[model samples]
Target: MVDRPNKPSAIAPAASAPQPTVDIADDNSSITATLPSGENVTVLLHGATVTSWKSGPGAEKKENLWVSEKAVLDGSKPVRGGIPLVFPIFGAPPANHATSKLPQHGFARNLRWEYLGKSTSESTTSGDAGTGPTDNSVKLDFGLYSANLTDEQQDQWPYDFGLVYSVTLSRDTLQTMLNVRNEGQLGFDFQMLLHTYFRIGDIGSTAITGLSGVTYTDKVLNATEHAQAENAVRIAGETDRVYKRIPQSTTSIVEGDKPRFDVVRDNLPDTVVWNPFKEKAAAMADFAPDGDYVHMVCVEAGYVSDWVRLEPGDTWEGGQRLRSLL
Candidate 1:
C-alpha cells in the first residue's frame, strides 16, 4: 500500500469575507455603495443623480463621471454634471403638446427622489467549464411619483405615474434602469433620457463610434437634418445633434485608439451628443471654469425622438449599461 501522508486535520471553512456595503448619508442627501475591490458609486437623492463613479483600487483608481466644480448640489438647481435624469420633455416644450407647459427637460431632474433600498448579487464571466472569478455587484433603487411632485409641477403636466430608477454598480460596469408605471385612470405621454457625462483626458483626442450612416438633426444649426458621413465622429465644433433610430445598440467613446467607454442601451433608440464648446460654455453660470468643458462630453441615451404614450395600468421600461474600458 502506498504510504499516504498522515491525514491532515480537516480545515474549517474560512469565515465569510466582509461583503460590499451601502451607506446612507447622515443628512439623507446621498447614498453610496462600495465594493470590496474599492470601486464605488454615489447617488444624490436630489434628482436621483449619479454624481460620482470611481473604478479600480488605490493608485489605479479613476473618476469616470464628471461633476462641475460650480454645480449646485445643495438642491438649489439641477446639478450641472454627472448623469442627470431627464423626462417628460427633452428640451423646450413643443407648442400645443401635452407637455407644453412643462419646463425644459421636465421636472424629473429638478425634484427629490426617495431611496428604495438596495440589492446585491454576484456575476461571473464565462470561462473554461463555465466557471470564472466572481464579481460582486450592488444595486440601489430610487422612486418618484406624482404625489412627490410640487403643486406647481403638478399643475403643469399632471399625471399619476410612478418611476423606479435603479442604479447598479459592479467591478467594471455601471447600469441604470428606469421603470415607468402609469398609476392613474388617464394615460400620459412623456420622454426619458440618461444624460451621462463622461470624463476624458482630452476632448480633441476623443472620437465616438457606431453612428456612421445614421441620420441626425442638428439642433445647433437650426434643426437641419444630416447623414453622418464618418464612421468615427470627431467633435470639431459645437455639437448638439440628436441621432435617431441608431442602427446598433452599442456606442463607444475612444480616445487615441483606446476604448474609454462602451455604452449599451435597451429600448432606447435615440442618442444625443452635446458639447457646449467655448461660447456657450462661458454663457452658463453653472458650468464653472468654462474651459473645463474640454475635459468632458455628454453621450446621452433616451427615447426622445418621439413621445412614449403610457396607458393606464401599463408599464414601460428602458435602461443603459456603461462599461468602463480604462
Candidate 2:
C-alpha cells in the first residue's frame, strides 16, 4: 500500500488521444502503406513492381516479388504475362501486327506507375499467417496519371490522353482498372490488354472455364476458333490465341489439383492465353528455360484484335479481377 500510494489511480481518459502516426512513404521508387486491418503492401515505384504484401503472424516476414524480376522484355523474350497491359498488338514485329519501332505493347505497360493511394476495409475475409485464407482481402490502389510526354515519347506515338491504370490487390483477388481519358482534340484508335499471369501447379493439369461461344483469333492456328469447353479449357503446349468480341463480366477459371484460381473480368471484352510450350520457350531467352513452364500461365483481357476509338472528353474503363479458391 505504501509503495502504491504515490501512484495515481489507474484511470483512462475519455478516449486515448489519437496516436501520433508517421506519414506514408511517398518517395519515388518505393510506395508502402499499412492498412486499417494491419495488413501492409508495397510497390517499387521505379518499375511499378509490387514488392511486398503481408498480413497476420508470420508476417514478421513479408512476401515480395508479385511479378518476375529476372524476366525483362526488351527484344529477346518477354515476361509472357502478368498484367503487362499490352496495347496495339501482342507478339514481336515481322510476325504479328506489331512493329518493332512502336515499343511493343505500346508505352503504357513499360511506363513507370505512380502511387495514387491505399485503401482498406474490414469487409475483406481474413486468414492466418502461413496457411490461411488470403481471400477477400484489402484493396490497395496504385495508378499512373496521364502526363504530357517528354521529348523522347513524343517522337514515338503522338497523342494526348489522360491514361490512368489502377491496380488493386485484394486477399483472394487482384483487380486492375484502366481509365483512358480522351483529352486531346482528335479521336484516336487503340487496343489494350490486361496480360495477367497466374501461378499454376502444372500447366497441363489446368483449364480455363468460360468463353464457350466466343470466337478467338488463333495466333498459333492463324485462324479464328470457338471455345470448346464452357467451364474450363486446359492448357497443353505452345498456346497463343486472342479471344475476341467477348462480353463483359465473364469468368475464366484456372483449375489445378488442390488450389484453383478463377480470373473474373468485370467488364473485359477479350481474353488472350499464352504458354510457350516447347520450341518457343527454347527460342526465347526471357523465359525460364523449359523446366520452368509449370509455374505460370497468361490469361489476358484485351481490346487487341479489336480497335477502340475514344473521342475527346470521353473516357473508357476496363478492369479484371483475379480470384483464388482452395
Candidate 3:
C-alpha cells in the first residue's frame, strides 16, 4: 500500500567545457598536467623544475626528459635529472656573491617556489620567447622573492630580487621562460644556466648537429679553447664542452637518421654538452646504479663564461624551448 515513484533519478549534469586535466596533490609538492593533445608533463614545486615530459601515441609515446630512477623526490636535495636551474651562479662561488654564503649553484634549485595559479595564452601578452604555439596552451607561473627568504637565506644572498618562471605546454611543444628582476638599490652581476637532461634510446650512436662552426671550451682537457672540427658533435667518452658566443641557431639531437628533439634558445648565448660516461658514472652516488648515464645527455643553455651585469630596477630574461620529434 506504499506509493512508489515511476520516474528515474535525475541524470548527472554535464560539464561546461572539456578542461585539460591537472592535478596538484601529494601535499602540493608536485603537479601533473595532462594536455588535450596527448601530452603529459610533471612539475615539482620545490625547484619549479619540470621532471618529466611525455608525448605521442601508442609505441611512439616516450619520455623526452630523463630523470634518475632514484632521484630524491622529498626536496631534500637537487633531483638528479630533468631541468635543474643554476641561477646567480653557474659553478663555483662567484667573486661577488651577495653575502658570499650561497651554495655551489645558488639557492634557486633547493628552495620551494610560489605557484601563482594557472595562466592562459589569452591572458598574457608576451614572454621571454618571441614566437610560440600559443593556441589552446596550458601555462603555469612559479615565483620566488628574496623578501620571503629566511634570515639565514638572506645572509647567503642579500640582494632583493624576484624570479617568475613560466612553463607553457602547447600541444607537443614545451617552452620554459625565466624572468629575473632586480629589486635592490645597486647593480649585481651573476651567471645562469638551464641544465636540460634529455632522454635517449641509445647515447652511443647519437650525435648533435649545429656546433661545427661554433667555438667551445673543453672542460675535461685543461679548460682549453678549441674550434669544433666535426660536422656532428659525437661523444667519445666523458664529453664536457661549453660552447661560447653561440649564434642564434637550432640544434638537433639525433638517434640515427632521425632527430630526437630540437633545442631552440633565445637570449641564451652559451651551450653546454656533458655526459659523465662509464667510469665517472660509476663513481658518483647521486648518478645511481651501474650505468645509467648512457641513457641521458645534457644540452644546456647558459650565459656563463661571461658575467651578466643587471642594473637596479632592470630585468634579465632568457629561455629555451624543447620540441620532441616523431
Best by TM-score: 1
> Please, what is the whole-model Cα lDDT of each candidate in the order they appear?
0.92, 0.59, 0.82
Q: lDDT tens string, model 2, 163-265?
A: 6666565544556677887887877677777766666666777777667777777778866565654545667778888777766466554555444656666
RMSD of 3: 7.1
Give the TM-score comparing model 2 with the true structure, all chains together.
Answer: 0.73
Which residue pairs clash in candidate 2?
29-45, 83-195, 83-196, 137-171, 207-233, 208-232, 208-233, 209-231, 209-232
Clashing pairs in 1: none
**Each candidate: RMSD to true structure?**
3.1, 6.5, 7.1
- Local accuracy of candidate 1 as per-residue lDDT tens digits, 1-326: 87779978899986664468999999999999998888999999999999999995465579999898999988879999999999879999999988999989999899999999999987666675326656889999999999998888899988899999999999989999999999999999999999999999889999999999999999989999999999998887899999998989999999999999999998999999988988888999999789987999999999999989999999999999999997
Q: What is the TM-score of each candidate against the true structure?
A: 0.94, 0.73, 0.87
For candidate 2, the 10 contiguous residues with the lowest summed lDDT are 15-24
Error of 1 at 71 (Å): 0.4
Q: How well does model 2 score by local distance difference test? A: 0.59
Runs in model 3 deviating more than 4 A are 1-17, 58-60, 95-100, 122-135
Candidate with the greatest lDDT versus the true structure: 1
lDDT of 3 by residue, 1-326 (tens): 86677867889985443346778977999887776556777889988889988876664557889888778978899888999888878777755556257788778888888888776442223564434323356788889999767798887777889999988876667888899999999788778888899988778889988788889989899889999888799886999999988775578899988988888987888889999999998877788655878888899988887888889999988888888887
Order of the predicted models by lDDT, top scorer first: 1, 3, 2
